[model samples]
Target: MDTVKPKDRDFIQTVDDHLFCVVGYLHPPDGYTAYLKYVPSPDGKWGKDGRRYSRTLPFYHVSQVENTYRYLKEKYPQYLFDCPVRNITISWVPKSHVKQYYHPREKLGEIMSRGANDFLERKLLDLSTVLEDKAGIKNRIGVTGSILTETHNPSFSDIDLTVHEDNASRKLIEALRELKEEADLVKPVTPEEKEGWVKNRAERFPLSVDDLRNIAEKRWNYGYFEGTYFSVHPTRTDEEITEDYGDNTYHRKKVVEGTTTVSDNRDSIYLPAVYGVEDSDEVSEVVSFEGLYGSLFEVGDRIRFKGVLEEIRGKDPHYRVLVGGAGSPNGYIKWV
Candidate 1:
């Protein structure tokens, strides 16, 4: 049987060969189940050179799946290619039905060891050089996203950089911010690029375009690298990977919404970024396994949020609404 991990992307021929982005701690009993993250489009709307394009797919709620499929069928029918819509979220394909699996770290290692061959790869190398010179993050960084799969169109693919280790990640981010401030080290996003990002975030996130632009501007980890967009993220080191969290089973409880203060966001860089909440009866904490939403909030921002409840040990333990799942959908945080 084919095995996969979080952040891996796979293709299913039964579903028009669209790429599904796997999320959550997968415990698929029969086959892999994930969210429909992207579809192949000849129009090049998703990327240059007719690369796969992404559309907004909601979280797996059984209830929302049908509506999502209808939206796709009506809005993106040309790309549908007659694939069954039910297969978008929880549908399983047997081991033999699996086609290809893309591993992020392995792909990053390949680019790092072999050197870049295309413009996107060269941009990554350029960014790496700057990071190495400025932040000492030469060996500690890896690549993720479309490039990791080798299907990336160099002209349109984004450079998804990941920094390992808590200290190094923090350092890398700090360096990126400093680079943006310096102006000479990195190029600024053009008006067109800024608008594109705003449009993209507006399509995928619940935040308004202005709020997203604000968040995007402050991060400094994303922007143009030789006219191509790139973003820097953090991951756990091998030492930080934990397999000791006892036997845990998950059940969807309810849709939770609240306005609460964040007591802490120190763990924002890690997966399932945990934040301690204060003065809220609905929840004691909020967690986002989705990386983008994780860092959106900070200490003291009263945020409006919605997500599914996850009961951790089932004995008055701290329950959290998982904000990121499936296609990185089902949850959003907005400034109040």
Candidate 2:
């Protein structure tokens, strides 16, 4: 079976026939195996009446396919792992995974075909138009999240936009800043929403209301528009998306599991997202590749995390416990 590359959404099946969404880039360092985040399994074993069965939990945290299978066998030895997606044969675990590639142009066409009154449709069109006209890379923006999955409720869903090229991403960030100030098209988030956002984020990490707002205010790529939240995630163009890190090589080291205290999140808006942590291990920073958790963790709260550790050796030897390295569930955060 072919590997699941970046920008692809996959429906993965385990040996027990349980299904999950591969939430991010699926090409693990070793192409033969996959590292995946556990989504609410789309299993119909439980009745799916209305929205009652829409979500399920006790979700297995991020794990490799074989590891998860082994863990389960120890608990429920009678359960068998057999189901595999197309083109994959079941080994101890199935090698097959089902994936759907994300096409920005095709998704844009679908959104355009919707009538004018559709809230999400109008928001997407306006944002794309602004980025295209100002940055000249309109065609590179792709929709993700609820809108991309077609499960969005126009009245409630926020816009999740992707800018494919690095240069384009920089331009989009600048453009978004200007839009928030001058364009009536993008509106400021209501005080109520801001309060709700602060409270919700504080519960996960220990940050004050002001600290949360300060980080958010600096990020030009996300804001409120038309009474809804929107975020622009910028990723390198296909040609630039490589895994090489030169002399600073990395690997999937032992999972660092502990409760640590957060000290700072002032630069929470950027990549290799950092937070000063202490009284845990030698690890000084909680670096996250996923943007969602960048601002999610704040100062003072006791956070429990398990992630791939990358250690740099030299005169200045230090460690970084990377969270959300491959996005949610595969990487995680919780206030203890």
Highest lDDT among the candidates is held by which one? 1
Best by TM-score: 1
Model 2 per-residue lDDT tens digits across residues 65-92: 4355464466533323332211121112
Native-referenced Cα lDDT, model 2:
0.54
What TM-score does candidate 1 reach? 0.70
| Model 1 score (lDDT) | 0.62
Off by over 4 Å in 2: 1-4, 8-26, 29-95, 103-105, 109-119, 244-286, 290-309, 312-336
Scored by CA lDDT, what does every candidate get? 0.62, 0.54
Task: Tell how far residue 318 is off in model 2, in angstroms.
Answer: 8.4
With a 3 Å backbone cut-off (N, CA, C), the pairs that clash in candidate 2 are: 15-81, 15-82
Candidate 1 C-alpha lDDT tens digits along 211-316: 8877666555676666777877676654564432234445556678888898888776666677888988757778775656656677998888888776655333
